[model samples]
Target chain A: MKVIKTVNIFLAIAILILSVNLMKPLSITGSSVADLSDAECYFVNSGVSNDIPIDGCCYEVQKQLECKKTSKDYRCYTSESSERYYVVNANALNYCKVGGYDVKII
Target chain B: MSKLSEDMSKDVKLMIVLVVVVIILIFFNFDSYGVSGEAANTDNIQYEESTNTLYLDSLTLKQKIAQMVITYHKETNKERLQDLFIGGIHMGAKTSKEEFMNSIDNFQDGSIIPMFISVDLEGCANPFENFQEFPALNEINTKEEAFKVGYDEGKLLKEMGFSINFAPVVDLDDKIWKCRSFEGSPEEISEKAKYYIDGLQENGIVATSKHYPGKTLMLWDPHKYVVHAPISRNDLMPFEKSIEGEVSAIMVSHIIADGYANSENKPSVVSEKLIGELRNKFTGLIITDEIRMLGLSDYYSDVDQMYIDLFKAENDVILNFDINLDNLEHMISVVEKAVIEGEIKEERIDDSVERILNAKGVNVIR
Candidate 1:
């Protein structure tokens, strides 16, 4: 009789725990940024036009910093010293200015 | 005799325990079934025509314009606040959740009259940290998870004092990265959007489906410039499907579809051929996209002129987000001028105001 009473108490406690678990609040987190691949170099160079080869040197900077090259007359760099010359037009330069890109005139 | 009584007592005790367990199981099962049955009944109520009404009231041109335009967050001023009392303010994308709730609370204080507060909460999280407290301005995501999310948000928004939610963006994008198509595909969008709309509207927050005739091809943001959508009748199928749903409001987009059948180069907002003719097919309220978008302001070159043209086209509501309350006030005056000129009749203004007031469920007149 003692053993039966003990088992019943254990079963009741287990059922109460399961019910509480079912009532637990649900939380959902957004997974928006998980798919994006990290870029190697992040730079903001002015005078880099939209005509620049996006897959070459420009792709790394664009994907990393969300920057678009708006000019044909421009230069970009991994560091300040190793600057690569990229051509962009005047209209593209204006586009860069409007987009708040930092242009260094070398 | 004592042994016989002991056996009988054991049997009685066993019977009582079995009865109690059965009662507990039945109670739990019935409670679950009852909750779901109530939800199904509410869904049925949405389709009933008993809720539809045609409110006919005499309203001035100013009241009509007030009913149409919603101002952005930053454009609230004393004159602007006064204008909202006289007219309504268009809640803009730039407006934070906190600012909107505070404005609504202040408006409730009788300093400014209650105008319709419309928000684009499609892709945004609740901008207010304490949004739960207001209950009226809670944000909801359009996901499969939306059933639970919307219920919680809608319940909270009702508590906070919000009456309208410009939400459940039914615009389906074939392209994956349209920057704002967070909901689903065309069929999926319809299903999820219906669920989300029903959830919010059931809780009393009016759900508005936006970017009408769909926004799948909007390459450029209309806030900056006129966007042209290059799609055929196939793309428009989703919007047509969406209209068939229990949507309370439909917001027209500023996109121009040159390729659309007979709608060459004309933005949907000014296209009487589209918004007036096509949308008339659906018996629902029609609202224009933001007046300040490039398609409206830059393309037309005159906001007042554009409003007149749009009104002539039978566009019901003018949506503007940029906080230029001064411009909204001028727009109201323009509509008033049109009314006096006999271009737009007082009855038309009354009809529009009635729809606006009914949509907001509040009276403008104190």
Candidate 2:
């Protein structure tokens, strides 16, 4: 009876481990967002500060912040308000992640 | 007892099978576990719906002409070159050909915009004129001399990966005292221009015949201020012949042509009737003399407006000098604004950008 109980306990532990492993998450990142069809939201932060030289759409930002892309990081200013919202697809969240800033999923 | 032992073996096999299945599932799940929350959020960020092919397809007629306009020494940084929306660079006597040639290696890496290399070699006495380092072809006097000079320079430029050359001043020197002119008559100038352009093109360099509508009678350099040319249509015969010969690119002179009703008192480079109506008489590329010249700069209060006008006038390119990173960004913003306002079409922008990329020998992503 003890031998049978031991086998049953081993099988139960294996199943539990497998289920836990399956529940883990996934993410992605890069210069291009073209491949992110599955993402729920997306944002481009050209990392730069206010008072520095800027061009294109970044200049239109009312805060006068410089939006520049660095080698390994992107820089830009974002508010905690509704202005920070991004449009993205659902599967994209499974494929990529954000760096250098705190981003909330919508 | 034997049957009972067999059943125990089967149970052991079943346990092994379950463990194998669990291992396989964990291995596949590992990839998902590695993704961070930050990356997941980034993937969900909103982006404009644009494809690589769509970007390439957005070229317009005006932008196509803009692509043919080449500049030298105006803007040096990647961001600034992006603003001019130009297809090439015309390196003047001031730029060292060797150093300029060596810079091509750096361009192999991708950039937001592309630039081509073109150099002015007329009246350049320096050994490194047009970036040719060889000892034999520095000062081209005879047709035979021009052959070697053109061939060797074109070869070097090609090896260095330059795609264009704005050279072989085809202007007739009617006035012997003019230091800039090389003492060639209209016929001789035409012949030499043909030979020089042909030699360079043969070696895979796009040659540009410049100082269009001629520059023989200008009293002062247009780079400092507006210079008047006293010559008539007869004096511009060489330029007409260059167009007839199908030169790849032609640069308009800043000097206003005398007795020409539409262009008098106005530099031919900026005049709509000249660059647009008259120059458009031909099919090749039409480029302005230089945007930073006092002739154009003094007249236009807003520099961005000048580019918009030039685009509207149908000239393919504008040569910009005294441009740096900051100014380039402003120029790009101006163009973007123009697009947003419907003053310029997105197709025109893409066309110019593609030409710039082609001149740089890089593949356009769109």
Candidate 3:
């Protein structure tokens, strides 16, 4: 019985610790430096304009969408910097504006 | 026998104590589900079909606050929200047309005032992409195509029992999603948007012109936790046209602004200055975009404070998609407390409820 009591106490303590550490609400800690990767650089000129440049090396978004067959004016290109995702028409139009080389997704 | 009885007594006491502790925790957790401390206006709610009158005073303070909030639709929330008389249910991307219809029926089943059934059915941001395809706004060059798209989309949405369509994004530029904004100069965009608004509203679907105080589709600054947009005169034109066209509601974005339109460094959704300015130009419902977005929440240390600010901002409707019903109830309680304390006036609540009922085609009588 004493052994069981010790085990229960330890279990309760462990559960409390896990709850405090893991049950926090999710927060978006935005990037400090720009991520010019394809996934990050996508959605230029498609949803937003890239005419005016910001003071950054890369642009980060919540999500990156692929080029839809229906949208010809809206094309996505791969970013030469990261080689991971596609930067859309806006980013492709003015890749040099944001200080990066925009590579068209062939 | 006596020894056995004593041994059982200790174990029974321990069991009772454990059960009591659990009961207390459960009670605390579910407390948000019950009536809050606001002095409920007498529950004599009635609608006279003969006179077409809805007694506004009949609703309790909780019901009024519930009417101000539009929550994300979940199967679990249907019955609870029906009881709370929540004003609206926003449908996210769902699998099928049948699923969307069924969900709408379930939510509107026992609601006193028919809840506003809303969805984001824009050019590229189509939730109905699986079942049907709609032309992206950028692809629509002429006002004729824009009107046709709006009228067709509105007709289908009404058939599906959707009351509101958050579309015709009037942001002057769309550098992000090139397909969202209509392809043209500000004046041309305005003309197309006006035709779309007329098409939707004529079909009994409330058209909401959105991301107001403009420049929302601009790129974000990663260094800033809350994104800010530099608004220009061109950015205001589409919205001005939307108001002139008499759109039903305008959805506010989370971008902080300070140029032609100023949010005073606060996200436009919670900024009274911006909302108040828009109210001067438009008497329609001013709605906040999804309140759960990090851009709005990041501006506040305490989430409860954010809820209070949203109410104080005087928006006619608030979109909170927290998914947890308890958090929603907690939000209602916080606003109720603010109202009781005079931080937010009950009259303000009345004003919003009146507008909401008006939009729903119900006549409100004080």
Candidate 4:
């Protein structure tokens, strides 16, 4: 009876360890958002400032980011940047995360 | 059961537990592990969805970044060279035919793309290497001498496996570049550079016209801090001429051409619109001068982000980002993470690589 009880306890302990191991994630820190689907159009800032850069948009939907941070998910901007947006990746989006902006990858 | 048999069963149970524990450890924390050189770390990062086969798709993200940096070597590190997969390397001044040939051979041999083995043989007396001398550039009074200067320099560089020379400082300021420049008006510099540029390319070498838009005209040295030149597009005509002359690449200076597209007074290295304007005008690769220059140091307060911003600024090759491989790896890692995080597109990398490969005379895979 005691030996059977011991086996059950050991098995229970093993199972418990396995569950915890499975629960321990490698890292759950940053954004887990999938990149924007192919062919999605987005705005790219000609000027950069304190902005997070993003990528992966449908090509057809892409447009110019009229101003610097004024654009969605945009960060860096120059004072001269007016309300005019250039298509994303048109000049290799000059995104700056220096301001600790959580770059939203569109 | 015998005592030995009982002991064996116990050992088997312990072994099973150990195996289970090891397997669990490996499975839960395997994200850090990589199969190749510093690339697997980007497993979680986002990448450009370029479907075209440009020979770049086959490379790991690390190699893609490597393609964008150009470093120099007092002597080459072959394994680290291949490991980093750097695009090009320049040697200081002159090297003997033997040292140059050996390192260049190994570098090209180990590279998947043809390396842009380069040197800066700008003038007659090579101040950096002291290998040989051509007549001083400014002293060359006639057109034939300019070509002769280029041809002689090209012959020596070609024999030594040097494919690129940062020469013909097209900047019109004679005082800043001193003897290194053609020391004349923008028109004169352009006229001289045509023969010089042609002489090098025809001799099977590529020539790079540097200090874009005339930093030489600025009183302050960009090697120190931002020189607010505030020069207009007209001032940069010599660089345009060199570009039109079919020089393979134009090395952009750190000086701010505030008058031209640069409203924020930012160095051209950090300004997209400034570099973009240059890109619009010039069809070939747009290379940055060097990242280690103090002008950059004073330009950005955050060192780490400065490295990231260099790429964001859209320079084809980040010349002298860092020399040490480990330090270079850290720099590369920051870029790798940016790339994976979708701050930049993979096609952005592909574009630079294609330009670099084409400039190096490597047939683009299309």
Best by TM-score: 3
Over the stretch A22-106, how does candidate 2's per-residue lDDT look in tens digits? Answer: 5421111110222323222223222211121111111112111122333433332222221221222323322222210112232
- Using lDDT as the yardstick, the better of models 1 and 3 is 3
- The C-alpha lDDT values of all candidates are 0.49, 0.48, 0.70, 0.59
Model 2 bad stretches (over 4 Å): A1-106, B1-55, B58-76, B79-86, B89-99, B111-114, B123-142, B174-180, B221-224, B344-366
In the order shown, the chain A TM-scores of the predictions are 0.26, 0.27, 0.24, 0.27
Ranking by lDDT: 3, 4, 1, 2
Quantify how close model 3 is to the true structure by its C-alpha RMSD in Å: 9.1
Model 3: CA > 4 A from native? A1-106, B1-44, B49-52
lDDT of 1 by residue, B1-366 (tens): 988678666755765575566557556544422222322111121111354432233333454555565554433364445434443443322124565567666655542235555554443222232222211111324444555555665675676567666665556652312223434456666666666676777887767776677753335431234567765664565556656765777777777765553345777788878775665676656777655434554567445577787776666667543333334445565676788889877666665666676666544331
Report interface Cα RMSD per prediction: 21.4, 21.9, 10.4, 17.9
Could you list the CA RMSD of all candidates, in the order they appear?
26.3, 21.9, 9.1, 17.5
| Residue B50 Cα positional deviation in candidate 3, in Å, after optimal superposition | 5.0
Worst 10 residues of 2 chain B by lDDT: B36-45
DockQ score of each predicted structure, in the order shown: 0.02, 0.06, 0.06, 0.02
Give one digit per residue, the lDDT tens place, for model 1 in A1-106.
4444554565566556545532321100001111112212222323222222111222112111122344434433322322222344444333333322223334
What tens digits encode model 4's per-residue C-alpha lDDT throughout A1-106?
3454465567657666765544332111111122222211233322322111232111001111122343443322111223212233322232211211122233
Error of 3 at B83 (Å): 1.0
B21-97 in candidate 3: lDDT tens per residue?
A: 55554454444334444433323467776766788888877788999988764677677787677899877555568
lDDT of 2 by residue, B1-366 (tens): 998778777777777777687777766554333221222111221223342222344443323343455543333354334333445554432244455555554442343344566554343322243333432222346666666677777887688666666665666652311222434556666666666676787787877776777763334431234566766564566667767766677777666666642464676776777765654477656666655444554456656676676665555666643323233333444555576688876665555455544544445656
